[model samples]
Target: MLTQLALGVGILAVLVVSGATGPAEVSPLDAGRVILGHLLPGAPWTSDGSLTRLQDQAVWQFRLPRTLLAGLAGAGLALAGALMQAAVRNPLAEPYVLGVSAGAGLGAVAVITLGSAAVAGLPLSGAAFLGALAATAAVALLSRHHGMLAPTRMILTGVALGSLLSALTSYLTLTTEAQNVFSVLFFLLGSVSAASMDQLAIPAVALLAVTLFALARARALNALLAGDETATALGVPVHRLRGQLVVAASLLTGAVVAVSGGIGFVGLVVPHTARILVGADHRRMLPVTVLAGAFFLMAADLLARTVAAPTEIPLGIVTAVVGAPCFLWLIRRGRAARAGMLR
Candidate 1:
């Protein structure tokens, strides 16, 4: 409980730091004042003329939403990743690895290049969500063996399908006007810079609802970890539980990917980090994963913006640099542990 509280505090600290340390460099104190001024009625620190309008705009209108979006995206992705890993029973499973993000990317790319009018008047995000669901369904179908989902096949299928979707996205980009290519690339790489209060709504609500649902089913998740037969024996309804997890994970991934454009690694790494901190118990791990994920992404976004100064790095690149090494270490650690057990 103390650790969870500490993580929550750390996430808030990171959010503040992210909001403050951007290009314009609003001080954390001023950032707090600006936020509190708006959020807390009759608060003493109400954006008095001590800060210029431009500074206020930078902090409140831009950085705050971006930072909040980063947290929400990270938390949602992390929760989705945790659920995916548990459902597939693979430590490495994640939204991107499973083609959900790539599928979402393809939908967003099509909308951007071919125009929304081409997609029967559906909104871009809605198209992206449908694409994500379709990709997940395809992977599930391909990976199922004898009435159960096979982790290895699921991972392989996702990789193959993700590659195919990427190719389609590339083809769409190449055929579009040259001016449209950069935005396409940016979306593919992912960024939260253009985040807005409006964009924050759906993801925030989705995260809350999904987190609550997952928590309610925490015991079922724990049972599944022991294998399908064991889970079935425990009355966990393995197939139904897995299906529900897939749908929940897909919805969460689609909502974030639609807005944030496929930021990777949080879902893959954060859950593992949570397990390391709190052990493998879902009840304990899930909450920690959510907090750790929010903290990780906020910190990543902070580095993404400030590391390059005026030129912001892509969110995906930053996450990859951090996640790749951690993933490799995890693999090595697993190998070493197995060897020790054999010895």
Candidate 2:
């Protein structure tokens, strides 16, 4: 039901965007052919002749995987944000806000800049996963006193670590080759251009599995919102659940970042949008956020591909441009809520 709609909207949005601004487009009929070729792998839908390998590669290799990557990336980031917010009981606990993405970026950047053996030989996947894991470890360590994550301490630690990582990434950019800098900068800008099937499976399956688990046990999450003591009273295994969610979501985010760079704000915006559609209940909110996040990124990725014509924008830039205003609006709304200016 919700799943099908999400899939339909995601696919349709990409198809429309591909037709409008894909790097070498054809006629309306050919657009249909492009989509059909994707749906059927090797369908004969060309106008004058058979679809060329160039065309096939253009549509299949570059565009389609990129689109799929965007949706999964968006969904994974959003879910991570949601879970983090619950785990820490904070509004500003996103991957970027808490420095997980930065940690991952710094780790991968270190490999790219210094660990040439791995960067030149192995795929970025392993580097990225290690980086994210490293960052998560730093956050957990800094926040834990005896054996628990302190919310304020965790956020401060994350911010500090994130700033440090960003500085290193910038320093590397300054010292490295121009082309290498551009490649590194793309990760900072956040993009979906590097997608491939070999890379896509991990995040997609992890996100799908986590989302299902989250949905099925949303009550536990919701109970956490009622405060830790209340959740415990209600039979929610607070520490174990938190551990499960954080590790699961972090792995998912790391997988996405390994491929998609550093897309921002989908996590922040999508959950807010979900709250509008279905109240603030995590059970309902989780699924809605997942679906909404995918849709938002698909639309944003379309803009990334088409809005500037030949000069494709990074998906992160579009999300920031659009999400900044939404962030401001949310901040203002929060002020209004505090002032008793709105219900």
Can you write out model 2's per-residue Cα lDDT over 276-326, one digit (the tens) per residue?
556677877787778777777877888886778778788888998987787
Whole-model lDDT values for every prediction:
0.86, 0.75
Per-residue lDDT of 285-317 in model 1, one digit per residue for the tens? 899989888888888888888888889888999
Best by the TM-score measure: 1
Model 1: which residue pairs collide? none
Candidate 1, residue 105: lDDT: 92
lDDT for model 2 comes to 0.75
